[model samples]
Target: MAFDFDLFVIGGGSGGVRAARTAAATGAKVAVAEESRMGGTCVIRGCVPKKLMVFASEFGAEAALARDYGWSAEPGEFDWKRFQTHLKGELDRLEEVYRSLLKQSDVTIHDSRARVTGPQEVALADGTTVTAKTILVATGGRPVRPDIACSDLGIVSDDIFGLKTLPKSILIIGGGYIACEFACILNGLGVEVTQYYRGAQILRGFDDEARGLVAEAMRERGINLHLGTNIVEMARAEDRWEGPVPTASDAAMSQALKGAASPLARREGGAHRPGEAGPIWVKGTNGQQDVYDQVLFATGRTPNTEGMGLQDVGVKVNRRGAIEVDAYSQTAVPSIYAIGDVTDRIQLTPVAIREGMAFTETVFKNNPTAPDHELVASAVFTQPELGTVGMTEEQAREQEPVEIYCTSFRPMRSAFAGRPDRVLMKLIVSQASQKVLGCQIVAPGAGEMIQLAGIAVKMGATKEDFDRTVAVHPTISEELVTMKTPMRTA
Candidate 1:
């Protein structure tokens, strides 16, 4: 059956772009429609920009350390305008690179929103209907505010990059990686950060000992973290304050004035407006009432399956609104496929890209491949990062008897500087097979360390295998190999 193209991709995110490019390379005509930027969540807002902020946020601590080392270093005020200008240029360049890559692969770019009109058909925002032999949906998820009154007054994670001036005081709500990471980032950047988590601890579902250390480190770094706390009510400070209320610091006020002419400050909804609205007055479940220059909700993310007409086209979606797909990413409708965050199968960008490749191999190359979702390593970019791979000790013990090898100590750099910071290295080992079931690290460069450790874990390396390797001495990661005894057996 001849159609307009061999493949029609609904989203131009990392997954969709990769699938489109790879499928087009196979001599199949392909086209992609993107309502927004080509890079999607990762390159545009989620990872790239947030990591840059994390990097920018760390200099203050580094400067303090340099002074302790007798380098006579002093941290200066962070210029949000200067950093944001550079960030905007970088994002623009990345978007252009994505467009160029897609064009090089001979894939058509629609540059508009698309919906699945029927089986093997797509309707673009521009009133154009395109039919294809196969359809791929990679529309990623979006950060959503909680269903509470005055929630719209608060900004989501996406709004952070668009903020013209950094708030002097921010009340961050949630305990996930996004919440904790930003709490540390804003705190490091000298914002008065108050974090509230409804859960008993932050970073739920992570290794308990690792998250505990992270929570402690965050408190030591001056983040007012409150566990088992949630916002009961919130309103604009102007409505509650009887007189003039001061929201931000003098420096932040000056920065806001300088950025007043920028469109971002005046933009309505989604983007943060520094001076347009006054401070936010929040009442927590713990009975604490306070005002913050800004309130950030890292509450959660929702898949972008709404209004795509998935159900109308016989594609099944779960209660959470994620498109249901089989092992090879094929949906209930045989010609339709979904990948990345839309599938809700491992929301990591790399995982999404892998799924896209597998989809291309299965449909275009005639070689069926299923993307492996096991033992995926991930990192939380907090002040003291947490890098982890495989099952947590809790999950490992539930399946079989396990041994926990863990250690916490003051690292050389911070200890020398008389800081109370400590790093944690832990391994959850299977007693039956003597295999390293999991590995977790909480320290500087944990992200880099976990990538290498993940390789070993992914290969099903046993404890003896790790023990056989020589330790890289004078390093935090060396503890992974050198720890000879289990702290506890469960």
Candidate 2:
């Protein structure tokens, strides 16, 4: 069948762009449509900006630590406006790089939304329809606020990047990495940060010990973290005061009302509007009521498969709105395929790029390829940070007999400064085969450490193999190789 192009990608995200560029390199005509800026979540909003914020937030502590190390250093105030201005410029430059890369590969770019209109056809928001020999969906996902009263008054992870000013106080909802990370970031940035999690522990589904240490570190850093707690009701502080005065049971509410009326909550002109940098009164499930300068909902994220005409064209979508694809990322319709967050398969940016490359290989190079999903290492940028790969100790014990080698202690740097900070290194190993089943580290730069550990684990390195490697002394990671005995065997 004659088509407008060999490939038409619906998203200009990391996955879609990589696929488009790689496919184009194979001498195929490729076109990509992106409604928003290029580079998708990782470059535009998620990783790049958040990491920069993480770096910006850490300087205050770094200056303090420097003073303890006998250096004449004084901590200073953070300038949100100054930092934000630079952040915007960096994102703009990255978006241009993405556009240039696609153009360099001779791929056409459409700055509009697109959706599947038929098996081999796509319709853009501009009322233009194009047919392709293959259709690739990489629309990615978006941060979602919970369905609740006055939830719109709260911001999501995406909105954090665009905040005009840092709030004096913020109530971050949810226990996932996003909530915890922002709680730390804001707290570090000199904001009063309170976190609520309905779950018993934050970072659920991660190693129990690792998450416990992270939660403990969060509390130590002055994040008023509340577990097994959620918001019962919330409204703008002004609206709350329109009713009768609070009773004695509402002492917390009264205190919060006073805070709302404080100069810190009010601006030069007037109090900010609801959903802006305004005071929000929140009633928690635990009977605590308070007003915060900002409320952030990091509840979850959903796939971007809605109104895309996917199902009508025989592309199956799951109940959670994720596109269903086989191991090779091909959908039910052979002519159509999906990858990245839209497929809900390993929602990491690198994983998405890998999937895109695999798709190009299978479709263009005539070499069938499936992106590997096993032992994918990831880091949660909480205060202490968590880097993990492979099975959790809980999961390993349930599947097979395992031995656990674990250790937790204050690192040399933090201990020298007389800080209470402690780091963790744990390994879950198969008892019978002596293979390292999992690796988890909770420390500064654990993200970087895990990438190297992930390589060993991915290569099926056993505990003995690690023992054979000489330990690099005076390092937190040396523990990974030096642990001679199992802390526990199951």
lDDT of 2: 0.91
Model 2: per-residue Cα lDDT over 261-291, one tens digit each: 3222321334444348366778889877787
Candidate 1, which segments miss by more than 4 Å at Cα? 248-276
Winning model by lDDT: 2
- Write candidate 1's Cα lDDT for 1-490 as tens digits: 7799999999989999999999999999999999999999999989999999999999999999999999989999999999999999999999999999999999999989999999989999999999999999999999988999778888888888888788888899999999999999899888999999999999999988899999999999999999999999877765554445455444443243333331121223344353335577677898776778889999989999999999998999999999999999999999999999988989899999999999999999989999999999999999799999999988999999999999999999999999999999999999989988999999999999999999999999999998999988788888898889999999
TM-score of each: 0.95, 0.95
lDDT of each: 0.90, 0.91
| Model 2 regions lying over 4 Å from their true place | 242-277
